[model samples]
Target: MDKRSLTQLTERFRESEKRTEILRQELAAAIRQAAADDVPQKDICEATGYTRQQIRRIVLAGETETAAQP
Candidate 1:
């Protein structure tokens, strides 16, 4: 590809990556909130298509964050 085309493609890829990261953080936050609110983990997994272990990790991370707060 030409230099201009390559630069445009690179910009698009960067934007896409940023969006992917934002969505991932948002999803993780949502999952953590639901778990904190006593929503069933299995239901969250089924709805979000994530494994139980992954959900557990996310919940644990949130717990750790709260414990560290002043």
Candidate 2:
């Protein structure tokens, strides 16, 4: 491939990677919030546009926040 084409492809790949990372972080945050709020995985999936398996995985990864003491 030409240098210009190669550069374009690299940039596209980088952009996609960045987007994926952002989504992953967002999903993690959503899962944590859902857990903190006692929301079900199904509800979190609906709210966050993530699949059930993705939400389950995020929850299973132990992203829950501890309850704050008064």
The candidate that wins on lDDT is 1
How do the residues 1-70 of candidate 1 rate in per-residue lDDT, one tens digit apiece? Answer: 9999999999999999999999998999999989878999889999999999999998898888989999
Clashing pairs in 1: none
CA lDDT, every model vs. true structure: 0.94, 0.79
lDDT of 2 by residue, 1-70 (tens): 9999999999999999999999887768767767779998778878889798877777766533333333
Cand. 2 Cα-lDDT: 0.79
lDDT of 1: 0.94
Give the root-mean-square deviation of each candidate in angstroms: 1.1, 4.7
* TM-score for each candidate, following the candidate numbering: 0.89, 0.61
What lDDT score is found at residue 65 in candidate 1? 90
Task: Compare the candidates by TM-score and give the number of the best one.
Answer: 1
